[model samples]
Target: MLAESRFVDLLAQVLPPLEFKLYHLKTHLKKCRKLVFTSKSDKSVDAYATHFFVLSLDGIDLLGLEVYIYESREYTTMFVSKADTTGHYPSDKPPTQMGKVVQQLLRGLIRYYLPLDKPVRVCLFAKAERQYLFLGSAKNPLKHVLSDAQLVKWWASCLDGLKSEFSSIKKCALQIPGASEAAVKSYLPSNPQLPWTVGDIFWEGAPDDPTIAVKRIPRFPDDPKLRFLEFLVAEKRVKKVSRAQFWIELQSRQEFRLGTTVGIFGLEGTVDKHESLEGNHSITQKEARLLREVTLEGDYSTKSSAEYSSNEFASRVPSYAEIDVKGTLTTPVVKRTVETPQVNVLSAGLVRKKQKTQR
Candidate 1:
C-alpha cells in the first residue's frame, strides 16, 4: 500500500463502505509504467498492485494516486500527498503545495504511469477546504492560494504537459460560480456511455431483475468469480439510527459462491445452526448482520486497535457486484445444482444369474 497519509484519508472519506461496494486489491494486469518524480529530490514510485500508484522517497510516501481501467480506458480518481506545512508550525516536509512539485506529479502520471494508446478520464469530486493550499498569513506570498475551479484549472493546465498534438487533453470545466465552492452543482456535456457501463451484458437492462445493474469483483479483464452481496433493512419502516449501511471487506481467503449461505458474521445472539456441510439453509437477518459487520472491518482485532478499522470498526448488497473501489465490475456467488448418483437395485437379482452365463 502507498505510505502517503493524506491520499489514503481522501479515499476513505469518499468511498465509505456503506455507500459503495468495495473489492480487494488485485494485481493490475494492464501494461503501464511506474512513475519517478525527480525535481527537488529523486524518488522511486511503488506501483502498489491494484489501482494505486504510490510514489515513495526514502521510505516515506511522497505522492499517491488512485487509478484504474474500465474497458481499456483509464480513470484517474485523485492525486494527493501529505498536506504542505511550509508556513509557521510546519512539518518536516511540506513541498507538496509548491507549484513545481504538484506539476511534476501530475505531468509524470499521464506521461509515464498511464498507457499511451488508450483514453483517460479524471472523474472525482475535489474538496475545496485545504489548510495548505492557502497562505497562512497576509505577508506570505510563497504559497499558491486557490480554491474550487481555480484549483482544478491549475491542475488541468499541469496535466496538459507540452500541449503538442498526439497527446492533447480537453478538460471539462466544473459548473461553479465565483471560483471554488463547497457544493458542486453538476457536470454537463452529455456523452455516450460504454456497453459494460450499464451492467452485465447477459442480465443488464432486465427490469424484473434489479441485480442486473451491479458489476462483479476480482475484476481482471476476464475474471470468472461472479459473487456479490446485498444488504437491506428488510423492514417497512426503518429508524434513522437503526438504518445502518453494510459492506463486505474483500479478502484473499474469502471465496463467494452464488446462493451459498456462509457462516454468520457477528450476530448479537445466536445458538442455532452455524452452517451445514451443504449450505441449503436460508440466512436470517441476524446472521446476515453478522456477516455485514465482519465484512465491514476486514481484520478487526478483538484486543488491539487499528487506525482505519478502529476509526470505524464496521464497514452490501444483493445483486450483481460493481467494482466501485475505483471503478470496475464486482461479482456475487452463484448457486449450482449437483446431480445425485443412480441407486442399484437388488430385487432385480434375476439379472445376476444371466451375467454368469456370459463368461
Candidate 2:
C-alpha cells in the first residue's frame, strides 16, 4: 500500500472501487496504442477499467478549447490525435489550460501507479463536444508541453515496467466525435456519466451493456472458510444490519472464520432451543448485527485495511460474507460450497511471528 497522508487516504477511500477482469489492464493499454497508431476501428472500453477522454468544446464559446480532462486507476494514458483536429487550427500548441490540467491528470496517473498495482490502459471516445480538427501529429500538432508522442512513450514505458511487475493490460478503445455537438449530442447523456474524462475515449456506436459493460470485478482464490460463512449467511442462520447500532470493535486473529451471534440488552428472544445465552444463538437479527458490527469495527485494528492491500486478505474476508440479499446476483439460498484448504490460520500466524522475532 502507498504511504499517503490523511487527505490522500480520504481521497482513496472516497473514490469508487474500480474492478476489471484479470489481465484487462495490460490488454487495454496494447489496444489503445494500436487504435491510436492504426486509426482503424471503433472500440468498446470496459466501464470497470479506468479510462480517459478529450472533449472538444470549441463550438461552445464559454468552454473555449481544452484537452485531457479525466483519468483513473485503470485508465491512465490519453493523447489527442491530429486526425481529430478541426478548421486548420494550430494543433501544435496545446492551450495553456491543457498543460495545467493535463499535468494534474499526470499526477493522478502517477498516483495510480505508485501503489505498484497493474498498469491500466483505456480507450478514447468522442461525441457531442464541439471542437476544430486536424489530421496527424504534424498536420494539427499537439503542443510541445505534452505531445501525443510523449504520452505514448510514457505510457509505453510505464506499461513495460508494470507488466514486468504485475499483470498484463487488456484493451483500449477510441470514440471519435463528429465535427459538431449537435451532430453527436443525441448519443450521449445530458449529464456527465463519469467523474473524469480524457478526450472522448470511446468510439461512436459502441455496444452498451451497462451491466458487465466494464471489466469484471477482480477475483482472488477463495478461502474455504469464507465459503462457509457465505453459506451461513445464505441459510438465514444470521442476519445483517444497515448501520452501526452501537460502539463496536474488531480484532483479527489471522483471518480465521468463526460463527457468532449476539443479543442486544433488550432484544426479543432471550434463549435458544438449546437454551444457550441469547447472544450466542446462531439465529436472530440481533445476533447477525452483533457479528457484522464486530467484523466491521474489527477492521481498524488490523495491519491491513484497504481492499487493495493483498490478494490473500481479499480472498479471506469474503468467507465471513455479509452482503445485501436483494442486490447480489446470488440469492440467500445459494449454499456455501468449497473444500477448506489445509492451511491453518494459527500456524500461519505463529510462523510470521517467529520470522519477525528472528529478524
What is the TM-score of each predicted model, taking all chains together?
Answer: 0.27, 0.18
Model 1, poorest ten-residue lDDT window?
344-353
Q: What is the C-alpha lDDT of each candidate?
A: 0.25, 0.21
User: Residue by residue across 45-71, what tens digits does model 2's lDDT show?
Assistant: 321112221212211110011122122
TM-score of candidate 2 on Cα atoms, chains taken together = 0.18
- lDDT of candidate 2 at residue 119, scale 0 to 100: 35
- C-alpha-based local distance difference test score of model 1: 0.25
Q: Any runs in candidate 1 off by more than 4 Å, and if so which?
A: 1-27, 30-64, 73-99, 130-146, 160-174, 177-359
